[model samples]
Target: MSRIAFTPTRVAVLGAAVLLTAGAAGVAVASGEDVTHPGKRIGTQDAAHPAPAAKDAAAAKAKPREAAALTGSAKLFRKTTEDITFTFDAHLAARHNADPSKATGTFKFVHLEKPGGKGGWATGRIDCLLTGGKVASATGIITKTNIKEMNGSRVGFSVHDQGKKDRLGYSWAAVGGPDGTKKLTKCNSAAPFEQVKKGTGDFHVQPWKLPYPDPR
Candidate 1:
């Protein structure tokens, strides 16, 4: 019998032929193996079952409730039909709820005699703040005032944010305040009566019931 010599070239040709046969059989060829331990596959975890894609960060976050509220500062500048200009400026720190407790901030109300250049003002600290929708109400204890009657009184007012022109209602202008009386309304306001002539600012109402504290 004649002996056949299998050289390195023949060995290489046989290996290529074996690979082609394995590929035809739909066999998964290992691209990499453990370097320390020869013949051990690197990725045994099912390639078909790939790790799930990372969850979308925004979609994974919980959505806020429909009743979630906000709190912040607000201001309004308006003029009445009687040629009296009123300005309200407040820096409120109320919470997301309508409760009067823990409401801390400052409030100021100023009025200018339109034709005449005379003016009076009242300034104080906020005691109460309530809001619902675009309307809001705020009250403050009068700490200082140029107007004698307003001294030691708590002022309250309501605001309606109507885009370009806002509506405002003052405590004294609500009921015309009684004549020569020390009794002043506190934490009470009327519906929006006077439209703003020119102003800038906004209020975000908290979640609450309708008929938002109109004590007029």
Candidate 2:
């Protein structure tokens, strides 16, 4: 056997080759791909360390997404300086420019002008609904009320959902113009006003890609 000489030039060349191989491996790790195996990714799911696909699927099934609709009840008001209270259940599809026939719900409003005194009360049926993002606009017709003039008149409501501290507003405050004045039109609601001091219920607001409900 011939003896191999350990020359400095040969040692340097070997070191450079090792460095090149290491650089290639670093590039593969940074790219997040397995160059040696096409169509195979290097991540939580690998050949030797297979991912738990069944477990992931089960978790997704357990926490299903909620359908986009407003179906629940809420008691709104601060009960202090702003003593007007509203309690109602709204069940309607978030349809853009939907007709009054497509909505169904009821609402009761009370205003306590004096502390611990009998206040005026009004009840109505929801006739129209419109929703976008986390906001819902609704309208109703007053069927019964202690205040004579309010009976038979239409009312508007706007809701801004924020978990348990959601905000709400009515047409008298949120809407303006020909519909808000002398005659409060149906299905017209502007931006929400920070009026609700207390809130309870669900408002699964969803975008309805259509025009506002017809005011006719």
Candidate 3:
């Protein structure tokens, strides 16, 4: 994990998937169907893309090992609930000795939730998972404010795709929060992005939220 001090003028910047999981993917019967989101019957390819994308082959061989390495790396965890907050990681060797009541560990959402015209984002949640020490799967809906930007203190999901030499198609977005109201507000979304392979990726963010869905 590398951190560059952020300044007013010189702020240094560092740094997909879908409901469609593996095994759920299928082949299209007719032409003009979406090979990406199969069976759903969106569209199809004019040509039969039988040749396995070289990108997928490479990712198949590499992602697992990369995930393992990330799982073993030490990470920081902080919980926010109300006025009480607790932060821990390789950076902090000392356990913060503060009045638990004063420091909260949940998120407070303000200026983050922007409802999508009619279809409100609902039925979403986030649960970060880690092993050995480092953050492996940030498995949950990361609120816009809680998300770690490219220049954030934390490193992005290089743990998932080791073959990714460029940051083009390697970014992800958040889901939802404690309340169902504020859905996934994407931060630093790398849109119009394509996967190098057929797999899911994790979304990293602040371990905790601060009074999310802030009453405005």
Ranking by TM-score, best first? 2, 1, 3
For each of the candidates, the C-alpha root-mean-square deviation to the true structure, in angstroms, is: 22.6, 20.3, 22.9
lDDT of 1 at 75: 38
Q: Give the poorly placed runs of model 3, Cα more than 4 Å off.
A: 1-127, 130-136, 141-159, 165-216
Error of 1 at 150 (Å): 1.5
User: What does the lDDT come to for candidate 2?
Assistant: 0.64
**Tens-digit lDDT track of model 3 for 13-67:** 2211332333244433344455665454553333455334655896787643221
Q: Write one digit per residue (lDDT tens) for candidate 1, span 1-216.
A: 136999999999999999988764453344465443457675664566443342354444644432322233333443442344333444333233444534566666555555455677667776666556677677667778777776777767677766656677767673564122335444567777766555434434453443357678
**Alpha carbon deviation, residue 93, candidate 2 (Å):** 5.3
Considering every candidate listed, which one attains the maximal lDDT? 2
Over the full model, what C-alpha lDDT does candidate 3 score relative to the true structure? 0.26
Model 2: per-residue lDDT, tens digit, 1-216? 136997999999999999999998898898887667656677646556455776688788886342233444455555454355666555554342344446777877676765457767788888777667777787788888877767788887777777767777777762331131336666775566644554445434544455446788
TM-score of each: 0.50, 0.52, 0.17
- Model 2 TM-score? 0.52
- CA lDDT, candidate 1, residue 165: 64
